[model samples]
Structure formats: structure tokens, C-alpha cells
Target: MAFLLLGFALVMVGASGIRPCNLAFGADQFNPNTKSGKRGINSFFNWYFFTLTFAVMVSLTAVVYVQSNVSWAIGLLIPAMIMLISCAFFFLGTNIYVKVKPEGSPLTSVVQVFVVAAKKRRLVLPEQPWLTLFNYMPPKSINSKRPYT
Candidate 1:
């Protein structure tokens, strides 16, 4: 019973960590503003869910069949081997992945925005873009089409 509880706790922790990160990592692959980027993200989500559903179906049927017909040990071994192979493939593709650094808690930043807005409510905003309180660089400054002078 203790071992079963421990396994459940570990699975919960792993799922909690991965669930929040997977969507952000996948979405980071394309810029959200551009047409192509929008399409890319949309297609990515569609395919991602489809693949997940398919994998779950396959794993359920295969694992159950193996456990019932062959041996419980071999059934468990199959998933362990698959996880090892998947991890290897993930590490191999690390160089090709777009890595995003962890910014401080997103909730903190959102609260900060609200606080800043309230504090600055009386102050008139500047007409000049550079003088604005919020530091946002225009897309033209970053995009490749318009090279910086």
C-alpha cells in the first residue's frame, strides 16, 4: 500500500511539472503575431492532441494484452524501454530546440502590471514611444525585414 501511494505521488509530481511546460514549449516554436506562426501553432496543437490520444490508445491495448497473455514483467519492461528510447531521442534533439529561460512567476508580473497602472493613473502618458513607462520594442526593430540603421 505504501509503495502504491509512493508511485501515485511520483506520477502526480511528474505530471504537474510537465503539463504546464509542454504547452508553452510547443507554442514557443512559432511567433503568435504572424500569419504563418498562427497557422503553425494551430496545426501544432491539433497534431499534438491527436498524437497523445493515439499513443494512449495504443499503450492501453498493447500493455493489457502483454500483461494478460505473456508476463507482467515483460509488460512493464516494454514501457520502460520505450521511455528510455524517447528520452534518448529528446536529448539528441536538444540542440535543435528553441529554449526559453524561466522568467519570474507569471502571476507576479501580472500583478505588477496592475499595480503600475493604478499608480500611474494620474500621470499623462508620453506622446513619444521611447518615453513610455512600459518598455516595449516595436516588432520592426526585431524582425529581419527591417535592418537596424
Candidate 2:
């Protein structure tokens, strides 16, 4: 019973972490700016959602029926085997997938800001604190094509 609960907790944690990132990761494969890219992304999402809904319906109905009527171990094994095959398919497409290089961690930059603030706590502040703050302006030559920029 303890092991079952522990397994359930782990699965919940894993699902929580992966679920949000899954859509973003899939969408990242296409360049959304181009017409074909936009169409591909839309199609990808449509199929992705349809399959997701279908899987849930099957799991709820078929898996539940199997668990109630057949051996509990076999019912659990069915999903496990499906998961294994899906994992295999994912790995097989590794060469074709777009590999994005990760930027530096945001948490590290946040920690550095906190550490700098703590070290500067003894400094005296001016009457207008906002005036003392530095604002960065980038050069026009370094333009970014990204929409966020």
C-alpha cells in the first residue's frame, strides 16, 4: 500500500512537470511566422489534442473495464506497455527533432540580484531613489527579429 501511494505521488509530480512543457516543446518545432509553419503548428495541435482526448476516453472506459473484469496486474501492464512503445517511437525520431540550446537559468540571475541587494544594504539612498537607477538602451545595430524584442 505504501509503495502504491509513493508510486502515485511520483507519477503526479512527473505529470505536473511535463504536461505544461509538452505543448510548448511540440510547437517549438515549427517557425510560426511563415504560412506553412503556422499551418503545421495548427495541424500539430489539432492532432495532439484529438489523440490526447481519445487516449483519455479509452483509458477511462477500456482500462477501467479491464481492471474490474480481468487481473489487476494485466490492466496496469497494458498502459505500461503502451507507454514503453510511445517512448520508443519518440527516441526513434531523435535525429529529426529540433534541438534548442538553453539560455542561462533565470533563477541564477534572480539569486545574483538578491545577493547584490543584500551587499548594498548599508549604502545611503538619495531623496529620489528612482533617479539613481540605471536604464539600459541597446544600440540600433543590434536589432532582433524576434517579436518579443
Candidate 3:
């Protein structure tokens, strides 16, 4: 049982990175801003996580059955096949996945927002009490209200 649990942990952690990327890509196929598209995306996820849970349950059942009645290799391979099938589906549907044009620029965009706001001397900057106590204020009117700050 310890070995089985440790194996489960390993599989989960290994799968964690790919799960978000796949779900977001799949859901991206729908433009949730529209009513129909929103409904379609909602349907996609309803099927998505349900299928995920169903697969897990089926795999667990296979493992238990294998442990009890079948040869170890045969039992393990059943769920292994399921994983292979799931991977194939993902690959086959890859072309339909939603993609980002800016290509992983979210952080860059966020930082730029702050930089642009800070550059425009038009907002209230957050005050550092230490600076005020030490009399370290800059000469110009401190307009440093950055949302990212």
C-alpha cells in the first residue's frame, strides 16, 4: 500500500504541469464572452473533469481487480492503455486548442503596466514612512501610484 501511494503521488506530481496547460487550451476554443460560446466552454469542462474522474475511477478499479484476480502486469497495463489513449486524444485535438498570440507575455505585460503608470507623474505614490521619518522624500511631487506596487 505504501508503494502504491508513493506511486500515486509520483504520477500526480508528474501530471500537474500538463493538466493546466491542456485544460486552458481546451476551454480556449470557446469565446466565453458570448452566450453560446460560454455555454460550449462550460459543457467542455463539464465533460472534461467528469471524464477525468471517470478515468481515475476506472483505473483504480482495474488496479484493485488486477491485484485480486489478474496477473500484476495485465492489470497495470489496462490503465496504462487508458493514459495512452488520453494522450492520443490530446495530440489529435491539439490543432483545435486555443492559443495566445502574445506568447507567454503576461508577466511582461503586468510589469509594463506598472512601469507606464510610474513614468506618468500623474498619480499618488505610496509613501514610505521610513523615508518620511528620515526626510528622504524626492524633490518632485511624488506621483507614484502604481497598481502593481
lDDT of 1 by residue, 46-115 (tens): 9989988988997899998999999999999998998899899989998988876664576776787799
As a TM-score, model 3 comes out at 0.57
**Of 1 and 3, the candidate ranking higher by TM-score:** 1
Considering lDDT, where higher is better, how would the candidates rank from best to worst? 2, 1, 3
- Per-residue lDDT tens digits for candidate 3, residues 93-122, read 777666654444467868977998889868
Looking at model 1, which ten-residue stretch has the lowest summed lDDT?
A: 140-149
C-alpha lDDT score of every prediction, in listed order: 0.84, 0.85, 0.76
lDDT of 1: 0.84
Candidate 3 residue runs with Cα over 4 Å from true position = 1-13, 102-149
**Residue lDDT tens for model 2, 48-129:** 9999999999999999899999978989999999999999999999999976666667677678789989999999877887
